[model samples]
Target: MHEWALVEGVIATAARFAEENGITEVTEVVVVVGELQQVEHEVLEFAFENLKTPLFKNARFVLESQPARFKCRNCGNEWGFTSEGMTEDVSEAIHFVPEMAHVYIKCSECGSPDFEVAEGRGVWLATIKGVKGDE
Candidate 1:
């Protein structure tokens, strides 16, 4: 799954950063996952669990949700994503299947796909604070 690769990349990045900073222990990790990216929370958590010991056994995965932001194609007004608000209207689209629950966000104003994906398109690390001990 792409999520695995993404998660592993994040872990590796964090590990490399910690290593470069001469930090041996990672206390906590906070990350923000955008909704438009459509990452599975359970799988992300499981991936984190499997790699917990390899990096820092006590390191924790903190997943924060970044709501989907839709821009208005007509009036340029933007709105946050909601299940019944934006996704339900596109149920007929194959990408918005009920089983997989995947549906691209459409502009609420002009109903156009010309708008940009601003908020919900990336996984960001919020913070990684810890003490670097000398080995």
Candidate 2:
């Protein structure tokens, strides 16, 4: 699953951060996931469990979801996105490439496809807690 790839990237980034910061032992990592990615939490958790490096051996992986929000350029109307009414194919398309939102979604107020993804686009390494070497 793509979750595995995502977790690998997260671990690599976190490990790099820990090394750069002289963190000897990582204890926690907070990851923020955007809703538009449509990532499966269970799969992500499993991937994290299987793919973590020695630096993250004891790290508690915390996941948070960020809701998708859009702002209309046409009318300056802002709104949240929900997949409730989308077909599986449409949802899958957006899941793989969130930029497709512009193709499939319209502004709630102005009914214009021209809009901006105000938030909730990709994964982020929100925070990392660890013991510094000199601590």
Candidate 3:
């Protein structure tokens, strides 16, 4: 599943960061998930449990959700994104390709398709905690 791929990238990035920073034992990793991505937390957590390497054997993987926010270019209106009224297919499409939001979403104020995703678009490795080599 895509969650596996995403976890793989996260583990790799965290490992590289630990190596570069001389962190001998990773303690915790905080991953930020954008609402637009619609990542399944259970699947992601399972992937992390299965995909992490020795460097992260003791690492605690934490996932946080970032609410999607948008800004209307036409009316200058800003609002949050919600899938409440969206069809399953449309929601799934946006989940796989966030940019597709432009095709399916519009400004709640002006009904204009021209809007910007002001926040919550992609995955991010927000924080990493570990024991340095010297420690």
Candidate 4:
């Protein structure tokens, strides 16, 4: 799925940055995922595990998820995603979509589907903590 590509890309980018900074021992990595992005944190971590070697095995991957939010196009009302936001819980609900079902983000105030993402809509590697010393 696209998640694999996405995760790979993230890791590659981070690895490059780490290398450039001469980060030999990464202690922690934090990633943020917006609800609308629909990325499975576990899957992302699993991918990270595959890439982890003796050096990075001790690295910690922390996932921070933000609730999906939307602003009503008509009433200017904003709302957060709730359990009601998902129509079904797939094996990996964060990454799976029903074949015939379309995901809708309806405005809580106007009961309209016209809305813009107000929050929980993107993926970002927030930080990478490492130490640099005598080389």
Candidate 4: tens digits of C-alpha lDDT, residues 1-135: 246776676677667778889887777888787766566778788888886654465789888888876787889997776555455654234444411111444567778766777777677889988765445
Q: What tens-digit string does per-residue lDDT give for candidate 1 at 29-76?
A: 888877755667898889888766555678878888887676655568
Clashing pairs in 2: none
| Per-residue lDDT value at 15 in model 3 | 91
Least accurate stretch of 10 residues (summed lDDT) in model 2?
Answer: 1-10
Better lDDT candidate (1, 3)? 3
RMSD of each: 4.9, 1.7, 1.6, 3.9
**Which scores higher on lDDT, 1 or 4?**
4
**After superposition, which runs of candidate 1 have C-alpha atoms over 4 Å from their true positions?**
82-104
Off by over 4 Å in 4: 1-3, 53-55, 83-103, 133-135
Q: Give me the displacement of residue 128 in model 4, in angstroms.
A: 0.4
Candidate 1 versus the native: TM-score? 0.74
Candidate that scores best on lDDT: 3
lDDT of 2: 0.90
Candidate 3 residue 122 Cα shift, in angstroms, is 2.6
- For model 3, residues 1-135, the per-residue Cα lDDT tens digits are 157888998999999999999998999999998899988999998998898888888999999999999999999999999999999999989988889999999999899999989899889899999999898
Question: What lDDT is reached at residue 64 by model 1?
Answer: 88
